[model samples]
Target: MLFADDPGFPGLPDDFIQRGPAGIEAAAAALEHGKPIADIQQFACLPPFRRAGKILCVGLNFAAHAKEAGMATPDYPTVFARFNSGLVGHGQPLIRPRSSDQFDYESELAFIIGRRARYVSEESALDHVAGYSILNDGSIRDVQLRTPQWTIGKNFDGTGGFGPDFITADELPPGCEGLRMQGRHNGDVVQDTSLSDMIFGVKKLVAILSAAMTLEPGDVVATGTPSGVGLSFKPPRFLKPGDIFEVEIEKIGVLRNPVVAEA
Candidate 1:
């Protein structure tokens, strides 16, 4: 069930996305009562929420990625936070910050939390997930590797571009292992990997995170990206001004952005 956040009813036009949790339930209940649902394709895809309370992300969750970067797999998830200001629409532009020598991409699968959770068990952690979306956790490589802290490199404004729309939990197939995550710049593939390579997976990350901090409804958690980033390429294939970034995930969808210098 796709839920769009369009605020107006607008005569229930075909494909009109139902807004709000109540609106989504009402639409489902209406279908049970034999009422029509606006055509699926007619509804415009909207972000899972206007703004998430927190955007938490995991680092080096993929074994291959750790190996590629010559770091040992973390004994525990390496967590970090990104400011909401970094967020951009799925099709939006990613304005590169000035004074940064290197910019790179990290394609990740991000999930939304539906309920407030604290110290949840790993076995039951997935129950809190509302849905999934595609997120490009774009980073500034030079700054990230320069300091022990990765935040300054990964959380710049317009770096967290995501969403064509959210794919509700019920709608997505279980066992995310085989999902394909690919990134391209100017029509050339740069990063390609499978979700199966993730070392921690969603369950463990969520359980561990919730145990440390409360995860509220609409909160976001990105599972981490695989290897093949520009930083890893020979001579380093960093993004330049006016470059197009296209990130695609098999089911969740694709998010495309153009690179531009900060104004």
Candidate 2:
């Protein structure tokens, strides 16, 4: 589906589906004749894609992140799921649940699937990607570590920060390689690294994931964060109410949010 705000196209629906290659072509054509939307930063941005079938996430995909966590790099990606309910848009508040004060930030690149594919090979995996965006996989550390499974802590309402904009795959280098990414707390840089540093790049991740199940359109795959998460610090530095966090990717733009206490 596509959401556009071109003044010339006065009757354009706020939400609509654009299917397959033809739909993409039509959207591109419309964009060529449309005027740019203004003052977007003042609006509450939604996740770049809505109604995502699955929100697949990878953990420790960066070697530095693994090292900082005192773990060996796994031969396979460590995958998890974050439901849509956990996601909040750019400029929205990320609630720190009252149960824990260990809220942490993880800066990640999120890829949205454009087409359905199963058993796809790494070489052709890029064909299935619609675009890329930013994600802050916020976690409540104490709860996340209480059990081997990380879902509970990771799935708390309003923990995930997504969007700002979705940049088409064609606008970026294939598989988004070599791009720089960083996580900033308030105004200070906390996590920074090159996308190339990821142990499992986009293509490899898609191939591996598709091998197990069909990747459907609008599904989101978060490539994982770098080192410098709160847990890796000498004294853990968890997020607190009034704190602001930003996740920036070289070309995809920034996903920013403010921390707030869960009411």
Candidate 3:
């Protein structure tokens, strides 16, 4: 979606999924023949798409991340929720909250569900995916570890970096497997791993999550991050003002954001 005065699909409603996959295909065809859309750099990016509902996140789905965090890789995926208010799009700033100085970054691949699904099986879970995007699951380390529950630390306003664009599933391999995932801090490569390293892949996550609740179109599921978060460092290098963080997933695209202290 192009971010402009009006923002998003010109003729359609802001919620692109109202018309479903066929609508997206039609929009693609129109864009090919119609006048060009503005270059993304010309405008402020919003999350590849907006989901007014659930934003489910997976934790420690990467073995290395679990190891670095000093937690056992769970038999089931570690799940958490992030409010939409916490997210900003490409070129936006990730606010380092004043409540905590231990801000951290987790690079992850997130997928949007295109269809309503409940009690789905792993074999059919991928069918629910409409598209995929990148997310910097930004965290406030101190608050995140304050209690057994992580929602508070994770939901800090403007901390989550989401999107540049949503790449439809057709443009990616099934379940987005084998892709490379990387995170950079101020242009320095800090985290790098293969999507294959994820302990619970997309299909399994979908199956597990859907069994518990319905996943609707536009609902997002972030599939967790590989190691190299700020908190994983020996001295714990937390994010500070002026820091630029990036999350890049091969085939999906890159999500870049600058860090700014909360005013």
Q: Tell me the whole-model lDDT of each prediction, alpha carbons only.
A: 0.75, 0.86, 0.86
Winner on lDDT (1 vs 3):
3
After TM-score superposition, the amount by which residue 91's alpha carbon in candidate 1 deviates from its true location, in angstroms, is 1.9
Q: Name the Cα RMSD for model 2.
A: 2.7
Off by over 4 Å in 2: 1-18, 31-35
lDDT (Cα, tens digit) per residue for candidate 1, span 202-229: 7787888998899877788989988887
Name every residue pair that clashes in candidate 3.
Answer: none
On residues 227-262, what C-alpha lDDT tens digit does candidate 2 reach at each position?
Answer: 999888878878999999999899888888999999
Q: Is candidate 1 or candidate 3 better by TM-score?
A: 3
Q: Candidate 1: minimum summed lDDT over ten consecutive residues — where?
A: 9-18
Question: How does candidate 1 score on lDDT?
Answer: 0.75
RMSD for each model, in Å, please?
5.0, 2.7, 2.3
